[model samples]
Target chain A: MRGDVIALDVGGTRLKGAVLDERGHALTTLERPTRATRTPAAVVESILGALADLRRRPQAEQAVACGLVVPGIVDSVGGRAVWSENLGWRDVPLRELAARRIGLPVVLGHDVRAGALAESRHGAAAGYRNTMFVPIGTGIAAGMVVDGRLLDGDGLAGELGHVSVGHEELCACGAKGCLEAVASAAAILRRYRSRSGAELGGTQEVVSLAAAGDTVAGAVWTEAIDALAAALAMASSLVAPEVVVIGGGLSLAGATLLEPLQSRLDSRLTFQRSPRLLTAALGDRAGCLGAGLLARSAMAETVGVR
Target chain B: MRGDVIALDVGGTRLKGAVLDERGHALTTLERPTRATRTPAAVVESILGALADLRRRPQAEQAVACGLVVPGIVDSVGGRAVWSENLGWRDVPLRELAARRIGLPVVLGHDVRAGALAESRHGAAAGYRNTMFVPIGTGIAAGMVVDGRLLDGDGLAGELGHVSVGHEELCACGAKGCLEAVASAAAILRRYRSRSGAELGGTQEVVSLAAAGDTVAGAVWTEAIDALAAALAMASSLVAPEVVVIGGGLSLAGATLLEPLQSRLDSRLTFQRSPRLLTAALGDRAGCLGAGLLARSAMAETVGVR
Candidate 1:
C-alpha cells in the first residue's frame, strides 16, 4: 500500500471511502452517513475528517492522491460540483477544496460516471471498447463509454433518468413520463405500495412479492423491465455499445430482469447492434473503485502521461 | 489544382459528382440518374463513370484523391458498405472498389455523417466541439460529432430515425411508432396526402400549404416538429452537444422548423444542456463538401499525419 490513494464516493444518504493500493484494490474501507441535510461546509468538514482518518491508518500512510465522486452535475474540467438536488450543493468548488485540504492532486467525477469507469477498468464491462453502464437505483442514469473513453459531457451527459418514456406519470423532476418515474428503484417501490396498498420494506420486498406470485408486484416488475429495455434500446441505437452493464439495487433481481430486457431490446432493434446485457460485477463499491482509478489517472497526469 | 479531389454523393435516385479544388470549392459538378434497379456492381460502374467524367474536366486534371458518400450503414473503419437498403447493397467493399477504379485514395462515408462533417467544417455547426447533425429527409438519421470528432460506431450509431416515439402507427422497418415513420419527409408527405386528399409534390408543398393556413398540413407539420424535438432532446441528454444542425429537404423551412423545435426541446429538458437549433448552411452540396474534407483527410493520412 505504499502508493495508496484515498477514494470517496459521496451519495445522498451515505459516503463510501477506501484506501486503495496502486493496483486499485482497497486496502481498507470506511463509511459514514452523508448528513445531506447539513450545510455544504459541514459536508466538506466530514470529507476532510474521513481523509485524515484514512491517512492515519498504517496501510494508508503512503496515500499520495485522492479521488472524490459525487452525485450531481459535476463540471470535471472546471472542477466544480455545478448542482446536486440530492446533496443540496450548488456550484461548490469541491475539487479545489479537497486538493487544498488533502495536499494532493484530486480528481472529481460524477457517481454514475465513476461507476462506469470502474466497471470498464475492472468489472463487468472490462475489455469492451464501447460500454453503457446503467445504474437503476433510487434514480436511473448511465455512464456511457465510447471508443474506450468514458464520456463526462461536462457532467450532464448521463441524465438517462430524465429521458421521457411517453408515460402520463409525472416524475419528481416535474417532467412527465420520465424513465425514472416508471423504472427506478424508488419509482418501483412507490408504485407497488400505492397499487397494492402493501407496506413493502423496499425494492427488495417488491421483488420478493413478485417472486412469490403477487400479480401486482409481477406486473410492476414487468413494466419496469420493459421501460428499461426501451431506454437501453434507444441508448444502443445512439451509441452502439458492445455491452450494457446494469448496476444498482434493482439489478440484484438478476435473471428476472436480464432475460426479459435482453429479448425486448433485441426485438426493438432492426439493424442496430444488439448489446450483451450483463449484471455489474462491482456492485455498490464501483464508485469507490472508480474513484481509485481516477486518483491513479491524476497521478499519471501529474507526471504527464497525456 | 494539383491537389484537386473528386467527391461523390450517391443517393437512391441519382449520383452527384464534384471536382473540388484544394480549398474545397467545387470546380465542376455533375449529376446522373442512380439506376436503382441495377445490380450493386452496376452501381459501382455508374460511380466510376461519374469519377471519370469529373477527372476528364480541365479543372479536375490534377485530382489525386476521392471521397464517396452513400446512404445507409457504413463501416468507414473497414472501408465497407455494411448494408444499404436504399442502394440495395450489402457488405460491398466500396472503398477498395472505388480506389481501384479511380487510382486514388478513396474515403467512404455515410451521407448524413458526411453532411455532419461538412457542416462542422464550414456549415451551420462550425466551431462546435459537440454537435448533432440531423437530416430529416426521405428518412431520418443523425451524424453525431462528440469531442470534435464524428463518431463512427461500426456504422450502427446515429440510427435516430428508428428510435420509437410512442406512436401507434407502424413504420416500414417493422417497428411501431418510429421517429422516421412520423417525422421524416416521406412520412409527412404521405400523412398529408392521406389526411387532406391532396397529392402533394414533396415536403416543400406540405410546408407551403401549412404556411398558407391549411389546417391538416399545419397539424402534420406540428406533429413532425414535436417528434423531432423529442428525439433531439433525447440526443442532447445523451451526448450534450452544443448545437443541432438540421439539414435535408425539411430544413428548407428554416425558422418555421427551428422556432418550434427549439422551444419544444427546451420544454423537454430539465438540467441537460439545451442545444442551439439551426438550418444547415451547405444545403444539398453538404455531402460534396464533406467528401472534399474526407479526401483531404485521406491525403493527410497518406502522408502520415499521425
Candidate 2:
C-alpha cells in the first residue's frame, strides 16, 4: 500500500519522519539534523524542509493527512505548539503551518504522547486498555493511555520527569529532587561521571558498569531506580495503568533495568494494583509511528463527524 | 415535583440518603446507622434496609432509578465492590443487589469520586473541565476530572491518600509516610494532641489553637500543609488540572490551609501550569449530591441510547 499519511517526530537535534500506509506501517523513512539555532525561524524552516523532502517521495502523493509530533508543550486541541525550549518556539501555530505546507489535514501531538499512542495501539502496550509509556532518553516524560485513548491534559499532563522525588540533585528544570534529574538517561550518565570522576560515553556504559559489579556504578543505578520507583508508585496510585512501557536509551539494558525497578515499585506500592512493567517494542521508531497513528485517527474522526 | 431518583452516600457508620427530583434537587432526606456486623450479609442488609426506609417516604414514589456511593475500592463499570477494609466487603455485587432490592436501575460509585463528580458538575469545580477534588477528612483520597470526564482507572486510581509523602507516621494501609498518615484531619488532631498531651475535640480546635499562636498546634498544621503541597505539586506536573478543589475536614480551616499550601506549591512547581487551589463547595452534602448527579446521568444515558 502507498503511504496514506505523513508523520514527523521533531526533536532537539533531529527530525525523524515517515510516510505510513493505512495500517500505520512506514512505507518510507527520512532523518536529518534539526539544525537548531538561536532563531525560531531556522527551526520552522528546517521543519518545512523536512516536509518538502517527504513530499518528493512517491508515497507522499497518497497521503491525505499529516501528523507532526514535537518536543515540549503543545495545545493539541488548538493546533498550537505552546512552547519548545529546544526550538525556541512559543505558541507557534504548528498544525496550521504544517497543513498549509503539506496540503493535508494535520494533527499536532506531543511527542511522548504520540509514542505512547503508537505503543498502546501497535507496540508493547497493544491490547492493554490502560497504559503509561515512559521514555527516559535525554530527559524523562510520559505518554498515558487511559481507557484506550491518549490523555493530553491540555498538553501539560505526563511531565513525569518533573515530579519531585526528594533527591538532593538539582534538576535541569531548576527544581531539586525531580525524577528526571535523578533517573533520566542523561542524568544517569552525568551522575555516574560526577560520582566516579570518570568520563563515560553514555547511559549504556554506566549500565554495563553497574551490571559488571562496579560498586559506585551500581549505587548510582540503584538510586536512579529508587527515584523512578517512587514516581511510578505515585503515578500508579493516581491513575493505575495496566502496563507501563519503558522506552528510551536506558530500557535497552532490558532485565537489568526492569528487574530491580519492578522490585522497588513492588515494595513502594500497597493496595494499589501492581502494573505490568515492560520494555517498549517499537524502539526509536515509536514517535513517528505514533504520529502516523495520530494522523490516521484524526482523519478517521473527521470522516466520522461528517 | 416528585422524586425521580434515590441517592445514598454510605459511610462506615452511617447511611445518608436523599430523594431527588428530576432536576436533582433533594425532595426529602434521610439518615441511619449502618449497623455493621459479623458478616457482609448483615452490612448488605443494612444498606437494603436504608433503601427500604427511603422507599417508604412519599417523596420516593416516583423514583425510577438509584445511585449508591460507598467507601472502598469499587469497580463501578463491573458493578462490584472489590474490597472495603472498613465494611469487610469483598467481591460484593453491589449494583446488582441494590438494583434487585429497589426494583430500579442502579449506578454505583466511589464516595470521594462521587463527591468530586458532584463538585465538578455543580459545586466548587463546576465550570472547570480538568480538576482534582482532594477531600482530606478522616482520610485523604482524590476524584480526578480530566477532559471534563471522571477518570476511574479501573477503580484503582485516585488513591492519593496512600501515596507516600516521606513522613514519619505509618498509614493504616500498612504504608509508611503516606499523605493520609501525615496530613489528614484525623492525623492533625492526633499529632497535635500527642504533642501537647491534650485531648482535642476535633480538627477545628487544633486549627483554633494554631491560630491563637500555640506553637505545637502550628507545627502540626505546617507539616500537614507541606505534605499536601508536595503531593499537589506532583499531581499538577502530571495532570495539570486548572483547579484543585480541597474538601473535607481540613478545608474548614480555609485561608489558614490554602495560604501556606499555595506558597509551598508555588515554590515546588517549575514549568508546569499553576493550578488554583480552593476549598470544596457543597460541604458534607457533596457525596449525596454526586450520587444524584450520577443517577440522573445514568438515566439520561439510558434514554439517549434507546
Candidate 3:
C-alpha cells in the first residue's frame, strides 16, 4: 500500500503511462503511439510493455498496483471495459488481463472520469465538495462530482457530449444539435472551416485568427462559446455544482474562453448561483494521476476488508 | 416512537391532513380549503387549525412527530420553505414554526418529492433501484431516484416542468417552450378550450372528449403526450432509471396517457434502455405517507445518535 503505482491512459492516438508515488505525484512518465487500427491485442501488448517499462525502473519496481484508464463505457464495478465505440472493444475483461500481465492488482476506470477524479482530489478542484470536470477537446464529456461522490450512473452517464443544445448541426452520434457538435475544440475548428471555406491548422489557428480580428473566425468562436455557456448553464441549473473545471485542449484558450463563457452563463441563469469556472491544473497528467488514485483506493478497500 | 404521526399536504387549492399509525396507515383524514390569498401568516394559522383538528383524534395525543409537505423549493437541510410561487410564501421557517406550535419533531419536504420518496420506499417503486416519479397536475415536476437516493440537487432539482421541449408556448415562469406549457393538465385544458371554443370543465373533460374522438381534444391530448414523451425520453437517455411512476391528476387518464407515451418514447430513444411505465399505487396519500416516512427516519436518526 505504501509503494508507487503504475498508471496507463489509453487514448485513440496515444498510450500515456506514468509511475506515481502514493500521493499521485508522477515519479516517471512514458508515451507511445496507440496504433488502434492495428489489432486490439497489439494495443493491449503495448500497454503491457509500458507497464513493464515502468516496473523496470528502480523505484517503480516496488509499485504495489497498476491502474488503466480507457475511453467509453467502463463497468468499473465489474472491472471490465464494457464498450468503446472508438476502440471497437466490447466486453473486454481489462482489469483481469492487466492484473494477470502485470502480476499486481489492477483498477480500471473511464478516462475522462478518472481525470476528473484526479483533478477533484489533487488539482484545481481539490477542496471543492461539488465539482464538474468537463474535458472539451475532440469530443465533450463531463465527470460530475455531487456531494463528494463521482457519479457513474451505471456506466451510461457522463455522456454530456451527446446532450442536445438546440443546435441544427448533425453529430457523428446520429443525433442533431449535440453539445459536442458545437462546443468541442474540433467543433470550433469545423465551424471556422465551414464558415470561411479555409483549411485551418487546428483550433489554435481559429483562436489566433479570432484574436487577430478575423470576423468569420471571431463569429465562429463566439458561437461556440455561447453554446458552451448555454450547456454549462443548463448543467449548473440542474446540479448546482460548486465549481466547473474546464480541461483538454480547448481550455488552453484560458481567459479568452473563460471570460465569454462566464458572462453568457451568468446572463442565461436567473435563479441558480454561478459556479466558479477554472482550468484544469494537471493537464495531460490528470488521467494517469487519477488512475493511480483509483488503484490506491481499490487497494485500500481490499486491505480494509481483510 | 409508538405513536401516530400528524401529516399535512399543502396544495394550491386545498390542504389535506391525516393522523397516521407508525406504519403510515391513516387513523383519521381531513381536508380544508386553502385560502392562500388572505396572507402568509393567515395561511399558516389555517394550517395550524387543520393540525388541531387532527389533534382532536384519540391517536393525536400519542403522536411523537409531525410532517408537512408543501409545494415549493424546500431547504430540507436547513428546514426552511425557501419559496413557493403558487403558495405566495417566501423564506418561511415552516419546519421550525410547525415544530414550535405542534410541540413535536417536524420534518418538511417538497410535496412531489415526498410523494416520490413514499412511492419508492413503500409503494410502486419499492423494489426498483432507480425510478422517476413524474406528477403531471396543474404543472409538471419530477422526483428522481438514482441508486436508491432521491436527488434534491440543493432543493432546485425537480423542476422538470421548466425543461424546454420546443413547445414555443409561453409559460407562467416567463419562459417559452417549457414542458409545463404543453404537457401540464392545465395546459391540456387550456389548449382544448382554445381549439374547441368551449369551456372544458377540467383535464378529465378533455380526456373524455379525446376518448370520444373529438378532433380538438384529440389534438390537444396528443400534443401533451408528445411533449411529455420527449422529456421522459431525454431523462431516460440520461439517467436510465428502471421505472417511471406517473402520478398526479393527469395519471388518472391511465392507459390514455401511458400507451401513446410509451410508443413515442420507444420511437425517440435508440441506444438507451426504455423504462417501464406505471401509475403510482398510493394515490393521494403518497405525500402524507412520504412525510410520515421522513419524520420516522428523522426520529430514528435522533434515537440512533442518542
- What TM-score would every model get versus the actual structure? 0.95, 0.97, 0.91
The digit string of per-residue lDDT tens for model 1 on B1-306 reads: 248889999987888889998788888899989874578878877887887777778987788888999888888888898888777789989899888876778899888888899999899988888888998888999998887877777777798998878888988878887899989999999999889888888888888888999999999999998998888877887889999999888988888889988999999887789999989999889988888888788778778764
Give the alpha carbon lDDT tens digit for every residue of B1-306 in model 3.
666789999887898888889878888888889774568777878777787778777868789888888887888878888987787788989888888777888888889888889999988889987788988888888887776777776676667777666657888876666788988988998887777789877788888887898988888998998888777766665566778999989999899789989998877665566788999998888888888877777787878832
2 against 3, candidate with superior TM-score: 2
| Candidate 3, DockQ score (0 to 1) | 0.38
Q: Candidate 3 — which residues are off by over 4 angstroms?
A: A1-4, A211-215, A302-306, B1-4, B52-56, B211-215
C-alpha RMSD over true interface residues, each candidate: 1.2, 0.8, 2.4
Best prediction by DockQ:
2
- List the candidate numbers ranked by DockQ, top first: 2, 1, 3
TM-score of chain A of 3: 0.95
Tell me how each candidate scores on DockQ against the true complex.
Answer: 0.67, 0.82, 0.38
Worst 10 residues of 3 chain A by lDDT: A230-239
Q: Which stretches of candidate 2 lie over 4 Å from their true place?
A: A1-3, A36-38, B1-3, B36-39
Worst 10 residues of 2 chain B by lDDT: B297-306
Ranking by TM-score: 2, 1, 3
| lDDT, candidate 2, A1-306, per-residue tens | 233988999987889999988887778899998875768888988898898789779978888888899999999999999998677889999889887887778899999999999899889999999999999988899898877667878889999999988877898788898999989888888888888899898777888898799998999899999999999999999889999999998899899889989998989888898888999999988999988888888777777732
Estimate the TM-score for candidate 1: 0.95
**How large a fraction of the reference contact set does each model reproduce?**
0.58, 0.77, 0.17
TM-score of chain A, all candidates? 0.95, 0.96, 0.95
